[model samples]
Target: MMTHTETRSAVLSIGRVYCDLIFTGLDHLPVLGRELFASGMEIAAGGGAFIAAAHMAHAGRKVALAARIGMDSLSAGVEAQLRESGVDLRFVEHAGDAGPQITVAAVVGQDRAFLTRRAGPALPATLDAALDWEEACHLHIAEYATLHEIPDLVSRAKEKGLTVSLDPSWDATLIYDRGLLRACEGVDLFLPNLEEAEAITGSADPQVAIRKLSLAFPLVVLKGGAEGAWVMSSGRMLHAPAETVPVIDTTGAGDAFNAGFINAWLNGASEEMCLRAGIRFGSLAVQAAGGARLLTTAE
Candidate 1:
């Protein structure tokens, strides 16, 4: 198994995909004996990887996705949407193990509740194609793919002088030791939210957590909703406040933020611009009904 090592400036994101089924206008929390009416209902493609990839592609950047989908009709629909968005879809594989993962979300006012079922693990592809990744500028991966599968990808990317970004989804109840830090040990930037930061550093302060993380990673971006986000890099911490807007849904704000920040960074924008872009993307996502429609369909 051989993976290509190149320092192209394009973004390659790998993560999960699920169908977003939402029902809006729940007047009250329904009890087991009660029937309630939903003001609206919508279905859209979403999930961590698909949304991020869509955002990057929407900004007119070269984006590719390494994801798994079911072989059923839902999977076919997802593939069609990805193709229409101009994302490089050669790496998307369909799984025979499980059908597509479907998320049934109920939106009440600004809050939502969801239930889901997944058929199998994210589809796996041969590394032969990554060996063909001669022009990828960066590699962004998350919970969708495990680190063991891409053990050599980071080192290869480092050798080619590419920026590496990682978002690790950790097990919350596990014992904290050296392994946690090592999850994102060698990368240019690490993005985690308030909760993840606290679990890793035993501190709730974004500033304090990022300051400590900065020693290991040259750049650290911690996201905090309403209180805004913080970027710590080059010995400077910047305040990235979220714009005032009516909160509709908070499904994909983080993924949207990641896309916006990285997209702007690659365009030579300042840290502020990167953050603002991320916030704007988040705001836009909240306004919509689903996390992925913003990227796949014209808004």
Candidate 2:
């Protein structure tokens, strides 16, 4: 564990943590009752919060991760990986039994699927403690479920003079909730992939969806994998082209993008520069088998 130090611009990220079992080099997804073989496999600490935090740390930003993990060997291995990535884990808590684990099968040039099992409930208490930490200048809500579990988190973060961002990493049930916009009341930035944006705003057109969301959040960043990313802020829109890369897996690409954008934003970069930074990080992330592995190596 790294010793904690007070920093003026540290980022505190809160969400679920998972030990990811990533399998790559698959031609296609397996059918029901069928077995599929992958050419390579990698184990890494994953989760939206952890991935983003690791990338921020790699970028030389002071970042802390707050999540609940199990005391089991798998969880211990995940923690070791995170610590190696330079993320401050003093806020991470250990729960009963084993932590959440996800087995992801990523098909080359295609989408991936996940099979996840969670051992306990959301970590609202851990999140609250991290918010009270004075070192954090920015707060990132890594998943919508965490925000849902702690409804007042955004408001609480703002009250502490912290700028907040949220990546509503896809949720099947909560995306349709009409109160989703209300839940994001005080968030400074709202990041969502194309699918999640359309699902939340019920608009097929990306522009319409972003426009609707921008009304709620001061800045709205819509991530389009491969195609690129879009930023809607104030009354203007900005686009950043995605860098061409041979993608191995896109497991945590969006989370990496969030880290880039947030890191740039915290440093007072222009919106265009922030979008480019995000695209750069996301492109690099997909070139490897797992999200945190490439980032840790880069660091």
User: All candidates' lDDT scores?
Assistant: 0.71, 0.84
- Cα error of candidate 1 at position 192, Å: 1.3
Compose the digit string of candidate 2's lDDT tens values, residues 1-299: 01223466899999888888888888887789989898888998899999999899999998999888888888888888987888998888887644645555555665788877767777644766788888888899999988998888889898988888999988787988899988889998999999999999999788888999999988999999977999999879888888988888899999999998998888888899889889988988988877875544432
- Number of clashing residue pairs, candidate 1: 6
- lDDT of model number 2: 0.84
For residues 1-299, write the lDDT of model 1, one tens digit per residue: 01223346578777667777777767655668878888877777777677877878887778888777778888677667778767887777777664677888877765667777756655357334643577777777654134444556567656765677766544343424456566555677777777777887888878898898888888788888677899988899998788787766677677777887777777777888777888887777777777765733322
TM-score top scorer: 2
